[model samples]
Target: MRTPARRTAAALAALLLCLAAAPATHAASPHRHRAATLDDLARQHGRYFGSAVDNPELADTAYSDLLGSEFGQTTPGNGMKWDATEPRRGVFDFTAGDEIVNYAHAKGLKVRGHTLLWHSQLPNWLTSGTWTADELRAILKSHITQVVKHNRGKVFAWDVANEIMNEDGTYRQSIFYKTLGPGYVADALRWARAADPNVKLYLNDYNVEGLGAKSDAYYALIKQLKAEGVPVDGFGMQAHLALQHGFPNDVRGNIRRFADLGVDVAVTELDIRMILPADETELAQQADWYGKMTSACLAVRRCVGITLWGYSDGHSWIPSTFPGEGAALPWDENLGHKPAYDAIRNALTAARS
Candidate 1:
């Protein structure tokens, strides 16, 4: 016969096994229970889910497959920029950009033209050459007109100007600003509109997800642009967040204010990074922030979409740019979904409900 202690131990083991076999709550398995893709969930609320991708990442079968399957929209990370589109002054090359456009089309994904103008990554010829205001204006017009015209129908939106304002609400001393003054902003938008009237034009920037000097500057600028019929359609908030900096306190309010200005807003280039060696607490906090951002966008009708800078940590630009800081995406380096992924799905589901 078995002893009383042995009998009690057997009963406890059986109870533990029963608990392990039971289904987890929604809180525990947010992504596991959901069968709908993110795009599908967003569509119910009339929003698009997207990610930015570099040209090289397309070569990875697994990476590309997940990108094509999960997201409904894609932005070319570097292919459509001034440097890649026109490596030589007046000599345009669309090979890299075209590759991405074709891939997006084949996958039935909408494309967002990544940036017609920026201070950095200009071709050496343009940077090296010294030109008068008139010469630069003509070149700028040509570049914007041709680039937009070439990708006319393929792209639904364009980041016409990016990072043009500093944190103090002053224009950066870029060549375009120095040579042509702030008139370049209006000229760029008008030129793009004239080239393709259907494409939505946007001014994109980083660190403007909340009320601040930088975003306030954009509010005034966009208001003036709209009043003067400059064809401004949207503002892109590049939410390149970091854990240490803490989440923006007024992301939803910020987006609402821009939408009230009679233009759409997009959470573009979003990635939440933490310091090296991410732990469970940091990852859980990351998930909460991701859900908050998604809910913020969904709360605003004019907030059209949200796009991750890159979908996976393996290809994220964080490690290279911010050393000792990585794991900034919803997917791990091995393409497995991270907690942020479930958080996003749950957020979308909650929004739809």
Candidate 2:
């Protein structure tokens, strides 16, 4: 026997919970409006941005939600590789990468096929198997050929080589380097170009942003690649920056140096992770960093796009992989927009002005 007032309150509570539990509908509040849409962003900024997604179910909705938004492209987290594409040498598995590519194609979003070759997350068989340098080169050729041919035109670009330089401006001594020597990178690019003449190819790396020795090393490689007629098309600067360590003040000069080489430049994986949710000072610094990075690109004709690694702080790979790291995105875990989003939007929109 509940009092009439109590009964009414209980009914209201249940209704509110039901509403909260239901998946969002179009009529929903700011959540829907805040959800970043690809069409809206692309049309508004006329620039490209993207994220790496792993699941197919979320991939479909995320692409649909963003179909025509600021982010006009998408990439797979760990697909389009020897591990995912050809895990057991001869057998190839296109399940995950294909799902992402098809969804982006359906939504008319440009797709960037990440990492044809990387030192990390490589298949163990590729590392462990006793293959001669010739055998390895043959395997590399076949892998790139099949993967490139499979997704040909759908992928707007491919990271033909990744992280080849050490922090101190020397070759990182990857397996390709160890087995077949320095020419391995050129060989991979040649094979990839032959497989898909239309695909824009790039060399991606981190911590080589400013005009330092590392940057000089990459510059030499780019020049050599051009001189050798390797069909190289772009350079991807992995801008995984931080609040504590701060960004290189000469970011603009760094980017321009590469673009000056007659190749496209992209901030391939841009994120600024703070140890904690931003304080007032941190927020201002982040906004400034975002604006500066954006300004540099907008000023450069060949700087094509700026892609965030993930959409939100919650899903950022920083925390799990780099302990004590968090809050490295333009959105929070709840999908709430942050100051960084507005900062980037303002930068891009203002850059056009």
Highest lDDT, which number?
1
- Which regions in candidate 2 have their CA more than 4 angstroms from the true location? 1-46, 56-70
Tell me, by TM-score, which candidate is best.
1
* Ten-residue stretch with the least lDDT total in model 2: 59-68
Model 2: lDDT to the true structure:
0.79
Q: Candidate 1, 51: how far from true, in Å? A: 0.6
Count of clashing pairs, candidate 1: 0
- Per-model root-mean-square deviation over C-alphas: 10.6, 10.0
Each candidate's lDDT (Cα)? 0.95, 0.79
User: Residue 340 CA error for candidate 1 (Å)?
Assistant: 0.4
How do the residues 200-280 of candidate 2 rate in per-residue lDDT, one tens digit apiece?
999998887777888889899999999988889999988888989868889888888899898999888888888765687
**Candidate 1 stretches greater than 4 Å from native:** 1-34
lDDT of 1 by residue, 52-99 (tens): 999999999999998998999999999999999999888999999999
